[model samples]
Each structure stands twice: as structure tokens, then as C-alpha cells.
Target: MRHAVVIIHGIGEQKPMDTLRGFVSSVTRNQGTDGKNIEFYSKPDELSNLFELRRLTTASAEDEGRVKTDFFEYYWAYNVRDTKVQQVLTWIWQILFRWPWSLPKRIRPFHIAIWFIIFASLALILSGYDIPFMGEDQPMWIGAIGTLLTAMLSYLFTGYVGDAARYTSPSPGNIAERQKIRKDGIMLLKSLHESNKYEKIILVGHSLGAIIGYDIIRNLWSEYNTKYVDGKYKDQLLKFEKDYAQPENVALNIKPYQSAQEDLLYQQNDGGNPWRITHFITLGSPLTHASFLLAKNISELKERMKERELPKSPPVFEVIKNINRFTYLPDFKKPGRVLHHSAPFACTQWINVYYENDYVGGNLSEYFGKGIREHKIKIKGSPWLRFVPFLSHTHYWSDDGNLKRCEASLAILTSIIWDKKMPEKDEKEKQTVQPDANELAGLEL
Candidate 1:
């Protein structure tokens, strides 16, 4: 009956340990578990190494000199297991409590108001000052003044805006930083599994963490054969072997059928059992699509156009050949296709919870446009909410309706983790249970 939860946070947000705790507690209560036999392990600080690594890699040449210093700082900061756990708890508290207080520090309303006033004043001055048209007499000073004001605003705001965006953007670096983070995350998971002899472990991730979760599971499956060694999941491995059998084994062992990287991990001598990860839940993920349409679409369009323009007439063959030479070619990788966003949906072992109204990266259309366009999209319908609407990628965890959807999704996932059959409820069936008001108010640090 030993069960554990590993919660990873989304981008631009610190670890969501508190949110997870609340969600877990709420679900357990709803399910009448009463938090009796559940063990929660939140590792918010485990990613500090990742953050530092990102910082070092992203820093300019002058700052790169201190990469080693930053690395050591992270090593010392996150080296201890207990300390990492405490850091996670601390981060949970900060997110649930300190975030509101610190909001002003990040973005002061007064500063915003002042900037608004300045922009308003400039606009008024510009409106009053006129510019001359080709045949009309107008105050030409207005255009000059407006341009000057715009230039001034650009000069003052450029760096601030850039930095703000950077704060939100994931670290842009070569493969090393990503590899380090992935390695660290896997190591942390392995350590946790070793420390806690949980029969079942669930990894839950939001945004980038979702990608990390996929990598971890893929790595695990790739490394260990289907055998649970000792009390360490050797049984599950044997079960898989018995269930899938030899032909399936051949399929898994074959390359291109399974990713080469995944195959390598499967063959690796990691003692950790990949199949131990019973369930993975991803929220507001954007893994299936490229960040830019140009990366995915332009080439597709070119191919389509080329096919259409393939000379039907023999006389037009030379003309078509010349046309092909001038066709547009897109650099697919330069725009960086959104990786791991589709992992949750695409993964057989994972359950995905999407939100309605995720502004930045929530729309499946952005990533799975071809599916929608081709009318090939299908989702397992929920009785509680027949349809989960697309929401802003970042807001899914916070929105009330979406949160309920997430809860329902987690309930289903929990059932999967326990290997219990999901109780079928008709579309008309409703659980009118209200959240415990006392528990909501009773969330102390």
C-alpha cells in the first residue's frame, strides 16, 4: 500500500509542492482515504541545480567564468537529500503564502501606474501636436515629438522587457544544460525510490517538468529489463516480460521501433526500475508542437505545393523544374519544435489533463493542428465534464473548473496506480460532494 507523489512545477513558477499537497489531500478526502497511509515526497529544491546550470550556461562570457562557482554552490545547496526535501517544503510554503506578498516586489502597482501616467501624458502631448500631410498644413512637431517619445520609451523599456521575458522563458542553451538537468532529475527520482520503498510512485509534472518526467520514464524503461530486483520492482519487470513475451521483446529491442536513446537506457546498468513509475500526469503541456509554425508548416506547405505543381503536362516539366528551384525551404530545427508537450497524450502509461483557455501554449491546435485539421483528434470523455476545454497553458492548475478536471483526472490516475478497475459512472451520475471548508481554511504552513 506504499504510495508516493513527486510534484514538479511549471515554468516561471517555483515548485508547486503546496498546490500538490492541497490537491492530494483534497483527492484523498474525496476518496475517503483521509490521508491515512500516503507518503508525499516533494523535491522543489532538487531542481536548483538545474536552475543554476541554466543560469551559468545562459550567462555571457564574463559570467561564464563563474560557472564553476555556481555549480559548486548548487552542489552544496542541493547535495543533501533531507535539505532538498526541506527546500521543497519551504518552496511550497512560499508559493502558497509568500507569493502574494512578493507580488509587489516583482511588479509594483505604483510603478505600473506611474508608467501608465507617463505614457498617457506622452500620448496627449503627441495628439495635440500635429503633423503636416503632403498638401495639408499640420503641426509637424507632433510627429517629431511622438517619434522622440517612442524612441525614449524603447530606450528605457527595451532591457527591462527583455529581462522580464527572459525570466519567463526556459533556459536557452546547448545540450549540456538539458542533459545535466535530466541526469539530476533521474538521480533524484532514483534516490527517492531507494529511500522510500513505495510500492507505487507517481510522477506529476507541469510544463517543462512534464518533459522531464517523460525522459525519466523513457530512460527507466530503456535501461532495466522487465524484472523487479528484490523488493525494488523486479516483480513488475517479470510481469511485463510474461505479459508482453518474446515478440514484444523483439519489438522493444529493435531500433527505430523504439528510440535509440531509449534503447541505450534500457541496456544501461541502472538499478532503478523504470516500470515502477506506475502513472504520469501532465498538466498544461505543450510537447507535441513546434514553438513556431514556420518550423512545422512551411516545409509541409512547400511539399504540398510541389506535389500540386508537379507538371500534369509534359511541356510544363521544365517550367515545374525551374519552379522547384525557387520553392521555399524552411529550417525546421532552428525554430525548435516544442518537445515533450505531446508526451503525456502520446504515452500509453501517462494520463494527460489539459485546461480550457491556456493563452500561451494550451491549444492542442498549436501542436496537434494536423490531427484537428484531419478530424483525427479523440479524447477519453469524462462523465463529470463531458469535454475539457482548451485553456491557457499556464493557468490550468489555478482555474477552478480546470482544477476540478485535474482532480477527476488524478482520481482516474490513482485508480490506475493501484491497479483497481475504474468504477463506471453514467454521464448523469454526479458527485455532489463539496470541498471541506475547514480543510481549505486549515492549510497552515
Candidate 2:
């Protein structure tokens, strides 16, 4: 069976294929499958017609470890239209002005640097330090320097942060663009499912793309969850989610649940179900701070989860035949149950990888749900630099990190993407973050 991975690039003015190529290079280069190096051949992107898009094919591990796979990218930066610096600034202002109690304790340390940047910018303006090279002696050069600086700031704020500001805020002005982004994404996945060329598909997202990926799957799952084959309905797959995925099951380890999800996928497929998305992989996802990105506060965030607006891990459950499940009856005559609106997660596994120094990311198990497999890795950085925001955001794909994570981000991806155990490395190299059983306890203010 062939596996397909659709990687979504994070924030910034990312070009088509850029993120995909970098990601493929990293994962394939550091493949932990056996001791043999994997070879990738450029293939025609049967997944997309666009010439800018690409597909990389790799043979499976000789030991039948990782299966033959095709890697694809869903580039959405161009879809995020009409981004404004003001919108970015407004979002930042709203975040910065929130009450201290509203901030997630673990995330507060990262904010210290951002606050410093903001204050320094304000101080520079108040002290008349306009541009780096703008001296009183160069009065005529003032216009040139100012123009140059304005363009740079515009690129940084609008070109990058603009994507996050618009999609996340969901103001009246942003709704159309946001909807368009999600619609295009859903259409892409729908196309893949319709193609019927692959047996399994993996959705991978990085940075802002992580949050976007989460939104895509939860929304996309609804279109297919009910379609289970005739014999698969009211089955164990749905039962596993209900019994073990409760939002309150804090101490629950999701490894077993992940295995059960794969089994359910295989059952559905054998029964002729076409929905083949098996796992979701997020790298440096800001969904960690979903309270600010998705709602006004933590309370509202939980309310959103309860209301089924946001999909939670294990998913929300209701009493069904004396068994708690995340399903509802769509047709009483049929006698089978349809997954609830937020139950797409019931059958899908979520793996989140974050750099310890990247303040933008965190363990989703803390806030989203414990079913999410969280790996907090560390990159090479000064002791004091580990607390900086955005410092390690772009290094997720870099092979040059301390890799104090469960393993290399590549190793983590290899294991989850292939649904196999970590490579047979020595125990000393398997540096991993200990699981913290705390609730969103300090996740949000």
C-alpha cells in the first residue's frame, strides 16, 4: 500500500514547493528506518495539476518498516489575501493588553522577549531614533532610509504575521479570506480521497500551518465520518474513542489509542470506506495558544470545544446505548451512528512536535487533549536563549539541533508517519521530554 503525506507550510511569504522540498529533504535525509539511507525520486504530482507543486517518492524500508510514500505540499500563502499590517498590529495589541491572568503560564516566558521588542520600538520612536543610518547630518537621506524601513516592516508584518492575523481573528473583513483558505484546503483533500490512488494519507502542518491543518481535518472529517462501510458502523473504532478519549481523561496515554485508530482505519478500508486519512502531524504548531488564536479567553476556548466548534482530543462524548461515545444517529431507520461534528478526531491520531525554545509551540495534550502525542524537543541554543519566541520556529526541519527531543524531529516523523517504533538507537540518545499531567492549568491566563 502507498502512503501520501500532504504538508502545509507555516506563516510567512512562503513560495510553492519551498517548504515541501525542505521538509522532504530533512525527513528523507535523517530517515531512521534501518541503517540504510532512503532514496527519493521526483515524481509527477498526481495529487495536483499545478506545475509549481511537486511530489517525491521513496521506496519502503527493506524490513517492511515504512511503506512506499509520496510527499505533497498544500501551499496556502497565496490564498491568504488582503493581509494588512494594521490587522497584525491589532491582533498583537489585543494579545499584549490581555490581563496577566489570561496568559498561559508556560507561554508567558516567551512573551517577555516580544514585550521587549514592542517597548524598544516605542522607545526608539519617542527618542527620535527613526532609522539605523539616519543621522542628523544626512537630512536628505532620511526619506530613503524611512522608505526602506517601511517596506521591511510591511514584509515582516503583512507578508508573514498577516496570514495568522486574518485567519485566526475571523473578523467580518477576514471571514471571506479565511473561509476561502479552508475551502480550498478541503477541496484539495477531497480531491485526494476521490483519486483513490493511495491507501493512506497523512496530513502534516508546521507553525501556523499546524493550526490550519487541525482546522482542515476536523472540518474535513465530517464530510466522510458517517460513510463507514455497512459492517463497520457501531463498531469498536467509534467505541474506543468514546471510552478512552473523554476530554477529562487527563492521565490517559494516547499511544494505545493511536494504535486503535489505525486498526479502525484498516477496518473501514477493508469494508470499502474511502476515507483514508490516518494521522495528523503538527510541527511547532501555535494551536498550543489556541485560547488567544481561536477565542477571546480560555473560558471561551473550552466553551467552543464544548459547543463542538473546535474539535477536542478523544473528542466530546455523549451517552450512547449506555456507552459514552462521540457519535449521533443520523438515520433512525438505518440503525448506524454518524460521528458527531467534532468526532473526526475519534478515528484520527494527532502527533505534535515542538522545540523547547520555540515559544510559539507547546504540547497540545495540555490544552487540546491527552490523545495528542506530544514531543517537546530542544535545539542547540544558549541557556538564556531557550526562552525566546520564534528563535527556533524555523529550525524544525534542520538536522543541526541538539535533538534532546524524543529523537530528531526527523526520527519522530519517521516513527509516526510510518506507524512504527523509534529507530533502534541507543537508549542514551533517546532524550525525551517527560509528560506533564497538568491541565491547561498554566496553559492560559
Candidate 3:
């Protein structure tokens, strides 16, 4: 099947239909395919499908109103997940591609949990006895339970509860609301699926649009596998089942990991059958650093601090260890992994586009400033450095170098689409590191 590309705009930004058309033209000018061969769609068009679910079932005025409300909530939650995923993805890319030695600001929540667990284990070893509050007699068991409970509570409190309003505010409430938005997007994609004219599908998103793209790809893959495969892809199916089998899975399934699935999606089966996606790209995404998204204003800061009761004497060392076990480990001189959003880190199949200088037009920095305020940290000269040379966040895509980088990145993506052989890495350089500019220039494209 021929490949198709879908372009989605960022929040409150102009749809990139025309700019994408130009990009396609530029790409095809030196390549084989023409611009028309690439399919382009806008975020609104894709999102509009989510709204159609309201008609799927009849309801009284109150019920219908509730449904609408629920849909918006889901929409916002989906956005939060998308943002997280983008930041995480960016962190991964920075670690792997940009600065392998330098850790990305965002650390996976799972990793954070491990860090805390290690500390908790140490605390138990040091105290020689489990603390009394855990209701366990054995020190080891007490430490383990305490660690688990504390980690769970911290995750629930910090990861979700603390951020709940942020996710739900733009659209809030229950599953019905979320389902409506998802249904809208799904319905739209279904229509596109029915067309069947395009063989390859490329998904491009910015910010929340990127999150939605992740959800669509995941749901599409799930539906396709459920309907088409008959245990042939059992291994892949098993992983998905393990990951998405619970009620919480429902939330995670629709969240940013949907984007992360792109990494696992293209893995080849024993029969050499690979899950195929034409391409995926995200621009100016904050998936790598999510602290940017939390409430940043003084009022929001005071409220969050009050809610968490920061003055509660810094979680007991034992509690701190337990909480740290699950949360992203904080680097005193550097921002925590919370900064790395998921979009860039989670992308396995597609090349991610990022800017060293601008991120969604300095919105990330502004948002991050708010988060810093909550911690009573000064924004200026803070550990999280802003190092933009000349470009602001919004203009990254328009810059000549960035545009070239995009082209180079897209070339790599195109190579993947055609199943072209990728360049082999030099074994001689196992211990040596390469510069980012050279790496970009050395792209096979």
C-alpha cells in the first residue's frame, strides 16, 4: 500500500495544510513521489469525529448534557497523557540521540518507583526494624509494604490527583465525556480507513494533537489485531493484553502510551510480519517535560503546596524512600525527569522533531515557571536552564536549519516506509561518542 501522511496542528495554531503542502513539495522536489501522493488532514477534522459519539445512543436532556461534559473531560485527560508522552519521548531522544550521557529532564514514573524502592530497602536495612505504622511485624515486609503503599499513594496523589484538574479542566468529568471525544476521533479515522485509497498513514501532531494521534494509532492497531489476527501474533497480543487488561488500563490505554506503542508496534513477528505505520512526527511537543504543564501561577502554586502540605516536615526519610521508589528521581542541580515529555521518547517508528531553543513558543518555560513557583524556587537562573540561541519556540520549524533537520528526519522516515536498508553502525566506535551536528549531517538521507 502507498503511504499516507496526516498532519495535525497544535492547540490554537493555524492548521498546517498549506505549510504541509509546501513541505511535501519540497520533499518530492528531489524525491520520487509528488506532493499529492501524500495525504494531509487537520487536527480539527480528526477531532471532530470524537464529537459524533453523542448521537450513537439516545439520552434525555440531562443525560445528553452529562455525555457532553464527560466527552470534554476525556478530551482534556487525553491531552495530559499526550503531553506527558511527548515530554518522555523527547527525554529519550535527548538521551539516545542528543546527549547520551546527559539524562533527559523527564524520568519514567516506573523508574522513579524503582529509585524510591531502593531507598526504602536501604532505610529498612538501616533502621533494623520496620516502622510501626505499616502494621507488619517483619522489618523486611514492613519496608516492602510501606514502600508499596507510599509509592502507590504518591503516584495517585502526585501523578494523577495533583494533575487531575489540569487534565480535566479543558474537558472534565467521567468516562462518558472521554469516550465521546475518543469516539469522535475514532469515527473520523474509521471514515479514513474506509476510504482505503491511501496505503500508508503518517500521523503528525503537536501538543494535544500529538496525544490524540497516539490514541488513534493504538486503538486502530488493537481493533485490527482483535479482528484480523487469530493468535498468529499472540506474543504481541499478549503484551497488549498484559498492559491493558484492567480498569486502570482503560485510562493508560487511552493516555500517552498509545504513542509509546509506536515503538512496539513495528516489531516483526516470527513470520517476519511487522506492524506497519507509514510515519509519525511531533513538533514543538512538551512530552519530554511535563512539570511545564502543571499549574504555575502564584495562586495555583499556593493551592498545590497547601494541598500537598509541603511543610509536613519533608516526608519521613522512610516515606521519602518509598515515594522516591515510584516517582521520577530528582537531580538537585538539574530538573527532574518530569521535564521530559512522552511524545519524543515514546516514538519508536517515527522520527521526532524537536528544537533546542523554542518549545511551543516558550509556553513550556512559562508553564514550568509556574511549577517552580510551587516549589518556592526562583525562576531566574534556576537549574532548568533556558538556552535558546536565536529562535523562539514557535519559529523552530520555520528556521532553515530546523527545516533541513526536518527534511533529514523525514528522509530517514521515508527509508523506513519503503523498507530500505538502514546504514550500519560502525563497530569501531563502540566507546567513542559523536557530536549532534555531525550525527545530523551523517544521516543517510
lDDT tens digits by residue: candidate 1, 1-445: 2445565554432322344444444333333234343333332343333443221111112221211111001121122111122333333233333223333222234345555786887997778755234235546886688789977655433322222222222334224444565576677567645654444456766665555565665554434332212222222222222222222112232222222222212222133334345456666554432222112233553343234321110001112322211111123322211112112211123445654433222333323221111111223335423343333344433333344545544555445444333222231123212334453331111
Measured by lDDT, the strongest candidate is 2
Clashes of each: 28, 5, 58
Lowest-sum lDDT 10-residue window in model 1? 309-318
Q: Per-residue lDDT for 44 in model 2?
A: 80
Encode model 3's per-residue lDDT on 412-444: one tens digit a residue.
Answer: 434433332321123212422233444223111
Global lDDT of each candidate? 0.36, 0.74, 0.36
Residue 181's C-alpha lDDT in candidate 3?
A: 45
> What lDDT score is found at residue 263 in candidate 2?
60
Tens-digit lDDT track of model 2 for 1-445: 5778999998888888888877777776645455545788887876564778878888767576677888888888887766778889998889888876688876785477678888998998899866765566777678788789999998989988888888898789988877877887888888888987777788999998898888888888878876763644344444554447454835776667776666656555555567878788899888888888888999999898888888877787765455566766666666455567787666778888888767778878767887888888876556544666567788777544233422457778876666654223233124322223252122111
List the candidate 2 regions with Cα displacement exceeding 4 Å. Answer: 30-34, 60-66, 110-148, 232-242, 245-250, 320-323, 381-388, 399-407, 419-445
Model 2 residue pairs with clashes: 101-445, 102-445, 103-445, 104-443, 245-314
